[model samples]
Target: MTTWDEHAAQLADTVTHPRSRWRDAIRATPRHLLVPRWWHNDLTGTLLLDGPTDPHRWMRAAYSDTTLVTRLGSLHADLAHPDDRPPWWPSSSSTLPSLIVRMFRHARPETGQNILDVGTGSGYGTALLCHRFGDQHITSVDIDPYLTATARERLADIGHKPLIAATDATGPLPDTYDRIIATVSVPRIPAPWLAALRPGGRLVTTITGTSLIIGADKTPDGGALGRVERDWAGFMGTRHGPDYPPRLMHQFPHARDQDGDDITTGRYPVLDIAEAWEVNTQLTLAVPGIETHFETDGDDRTAYLLHADGSWARAHGHWTDAPTVHQSGPRRLWDVLERIRHKLNIEGSLGLYGYRVHIEPNGRCHISQGGWTAVIE
Candidate 1:
């Protein structure tokens, strides 16, 4: 097999663009050092460990561009020994390169502007910023002190020393910056981010409500104005400290265990959630706090939707069942999902695409769509 560096080189060659300057930075920096310890998450919680003790497995996992979860649910993956191969989902990771590059484009930092990076995952991004603007002009923050410390050491190993702080970015940022980029998604764009930007400065971040990428400039009037980049980039939502709010096991106790009520058969295989963002987001506008899950049992398929208001719905059907049938509660959850799906199919897509955010001086956010038609609050 080719050496890991060879793979990085190949990817760098293929992805050349105005955004490709970071490619060289990616190739030059040793990503493995920055992510020596990481964690993964699962339905139960996070599993902490040093991934793949086998030298071969370690090298392959370390070099691939895919994000590796280093920490989850208070378990640091780096801390786990080699003999232990624990099953867990990814909680935090070195985000995918394409998404990272799109974000850099959104920040639009000039050669002279100072930059701040929130969520110093692997310090890979910090090095990229430092490569362009020098370490003096970049500041990186993470909620975990160990992550910041590890990032600092590895960054220094590469001779890049942008500030890596162990602090909560949701609170006051350490300093004002000409550009701020965050790798974590937040449900709401924190008000302090607007306060931290210098006039005309840009803030590129993911809006938490959906997988929306927003790029806005700090106006002299104080609101930030920018539009969503046309891509889907998901990062773990920001955590106040070591971990985010735990998954509510009881919220879906029946999800994996008991048979659900109003359970009709399902016709579709498990669909990727990313594919439903537009319709889902649109539906959320009509009905908030509604979530969905899908499952399959060889011959049959099932989809579930739950709302905090104690309403739930389940749809069960197979190819044989056609005509997509299902059941619902006091509020019909399946109807809402199917309606959104149908609306998307009719419109050829959902309106959640290509949104623009207008942050007014008072911190109220106004979102708009094509032709800048603002979404009413």
Candidate 2:
């Protein structure tokens, strides 16, 4: 219907300046065809939204500038029933159009240069790249064979056929690229990617478990140096196989209700890591792989931090109130968070945004802002 096109134009209006290059591409591509079915949840159970059954709602979901979950845990939306209660984790999605355009702007690709599009979920991004750079110069890769195969078929339906391959993006790449834009986050920059980048090439990706977006250019000595973007963006962490590693819910029972090994009062006001971008990035860099959950009820707020290594922290408090923190395991979780909070208080801002990023050939990433620094080894 004409509504999808109107919605694309509406989405394009939100992105400005550098991202304007892909405005025409955004309007021309049909997102409805790419995402025939998707998943949504209201916390209690998941619902499958298919275009054929509910065209009106489907059009709204597909065209809006929002992420439409295509797969949850191991079940794809195409195979799921209306009443199935899948896991909350989003395994795959058609990323928001604005974010895709923003990332493309960050990559700064020219007309003739070869590009690699990692994480071809719905192939919408791939279609945009093909429309701009031509079919021969674009290669889209994903870990799942079914996804890649379906995406390839979808691309062909629009008469745009690019090289779609099913392979692990973190391992050996299929080809060298002038621009590598990944829609998936990685724990560390893979050495294979660094090697595959041509000299003076650029890589746009996010650090896993955080919203830190990096724009780095390849250096002469096989390393790359650049800076983090001022704005925050994140994607699903890279999946090595059919699914990601198991979550930390198994350790919940032990920390559900207890005095914990350590008890202390939080120094600052209750912080919701999800809403605090700068703090989230800083804490993620300081204590990598920490999982956070936050909830609010009237004046009271509750937060939980869990790690895969049996570490957990639960904080409960209200606005302007000192939160009583309960933490247990090998590491003191709240202590680390408090340290980050204190650093932010001293330094006007966390300085995580626009921090200098340096990636060595050995896969070590170094980030610095003012005197504070973090190294991901």
Candidate 3:
């Protein structure tokens, strides 16, 4: 066996910034060793991603830049014996290599500076961080004790030791940091995160509702200053415990089996919203709590954007009646979406990408794009 080295190098070459220091970490680190066993989703549940059936594909996938989830709910997918196949929802993972590199680019950590890494998922990124800086300069935290323990052991196996804290990262950290990079999306840049930075320190984060990249600098008054939307990054929300909250369908009575409009045909396939960053971020700004879902039943395509305001829009394209649309409640979802897309198409860009993220001591947050500004609580 040539080991994963040969293929790892091949994968490294495919990255956007081939010469970046972070790419070198991806190349040097044997990812399979960090995640020997992992999970994949099935219609009913999650299953291990590998088996003895095909060793070569397993080797390739394990070392490639692709992501693999290792934990879900309280279950450790990697702990499943060879004979066991368990189903699970992804709760933690080793993020894809490209995303990690983007985060490092946004973090812009100085040489020898102390860093706090939130959500130390498979410790892959942590290892890369330690490799870039020294062992004493890294501190990783996760809410799950098992995750923290697993990452700590993986770090030791790689012959590096960084402090690991098994606590929620939304609150205060034990030590102040020069740079803080969170791997999970947050509702807002938590006050503790801003407070933990030394003066002029940087906090790199992504807003959960919008996936906007925010980089802030620490000020003297325990408050911090920074801007959002300079980069594009996203992660699952910061989970507090073994299980994340149930989906909104479980909370809202109308979310499931609603009487509004059940016979809607959609105009788009479940569009990968990431593909439409312009429209996505634009509408995310105009409508804070709205979530869009799309589906296609062959020719009958449907698009649905739902909001907490009891407003919903359903458009069925390809219909003989010119794509029937049904909307109910206070606001019009389709109108807002079309307006956002039209603005982007006319301007050739959505200003959200050009916005800045600012933070305050009272935990106030604001975003400004294209002369438009809004506050985030």
Candidate 4:
């Protein structure tokens, strides 16, 4: 039998440096207690795993550096029956240990400084923080009452107690902190975050709909200035309620095969926009609020792009071949994608990384690199 301590040590060795300060914290924390039950997706469908029933598999999963989804739609795995199948989209998860450590390293918190942990999902990250710094310097918050309450109990069982609260991180926070790190992604930096950050404080988070991780330091005028990190990370977007709103899936069916106002042979092969992180990021910056879906049957592939403003585009063809694109509404979504691809081909890179970011107090972001600039309002 592999003891959990041995597993923890192995996990620590794999994810962190031998001399890293976080190694000890990772070794000391027991991850299984925080996530006793979670949902696992396999080829057939989503499956629920009950830890106590299978201790060996539980230890392997809990200690491994992989995210475990704990909630689907509004249904929590804890409250669900063994036979129930919740929605496919994950609402909350215990983020992988390495990513948590990566974000912490970006913040670079020193001892005796207060830290706010946003999106208290499994409380595993809070436990690590308590072990690294004292519990007195840690505070974790989430919008879901059940998540906070359950996390508080689990944390207490592990002999750690940090201030755990049910509050919306996008709105007013509970108190001031020297560093704020959010596991959930936000479309824009909320104004309340700037006000809650102490002078000379730092904030580390990811922008929604992109894999860009931002590390910003507070400015004198209650704003922030920083740049996009070279490393990329993706997180679930912040939600005010139990689950995110319905996706634009209704538009997908129509766009799948219907003729559009304009049709043409695409200059490039069909691309899965969701999987191409850099291309997806650039497209989000160029045309915000677009939803994408991709499907494949045999060697033929189809990709659809839909927006709330009655705009849509569909491209379909064999893999590696130029697709036939159909587009409608005010914007030509496929043309926009081609223009972006054209730039990528011409420049050899998108230059999204290392872009300078200037955030106003109201959370409007002015991002630029060289002569190019874009605003996130």
For model 4 the local lDDT of residue 84 reads 89
Among the numbered candidates, top lDDT falls to 4
| Per-prediction CA RMSD (Å) | 3.9, 2.1, 3.5, 1.1
- Candidate rank order under TM-score: 4, 2, 3, 1
Give the alpha carbon lDDT tens digit for every residue of 107-161 in model 3: 8898879999998988888888988888899999999888889888877987879
Query: After superposing candidate 2, which stretches have Cα over 4 Å from the reference?
Result: 1-3, 16-19, 43-45, 295-300, 318-320
Give candidate 1 regions above 4 Å deviation: 1-7, 37-59, 83-87, 254-275, 319-331, 370-377
Which TM-score value belongs to model 2?
A: 0.93
The TM-score obtained by model 3 is 0.85
lDDT score of residue 151 within candidate 2: 91
* Residue 56 miss distance in model 4 (angstroms): 1.1
List candidate 3 stretches off by more than 4 Å: 16-19, 41-46, 51-55, 72-74, 80-89, 251-275, 308-310, 319-322, 329-331
Write the number of the candidate with greater lDDT, choosing between 1 and 2.
2
lDDT of 4 by residue, 83-201 (tens): 98876799999999999999999998999999999999999999999999999999999999999999999999989999999999999999999999999999999999999999999
Candidate 2 lDDT over 168-215, as tens digits, reads 999999999999999999999989889999989999999987888999
Q: Pairs clashing in candidate 2?
A: none
On residues 288-345, what C-alpha lDDT tens digit does candidate 1 reach at each position?
Answer: 5566666777767665667677677655556346424444346776666666677666
> What overall lDDT goes with each candidate model?
0.69, 0.87, 0.74, 0.92
Tell me which residue pairs clash in candidate 4: none
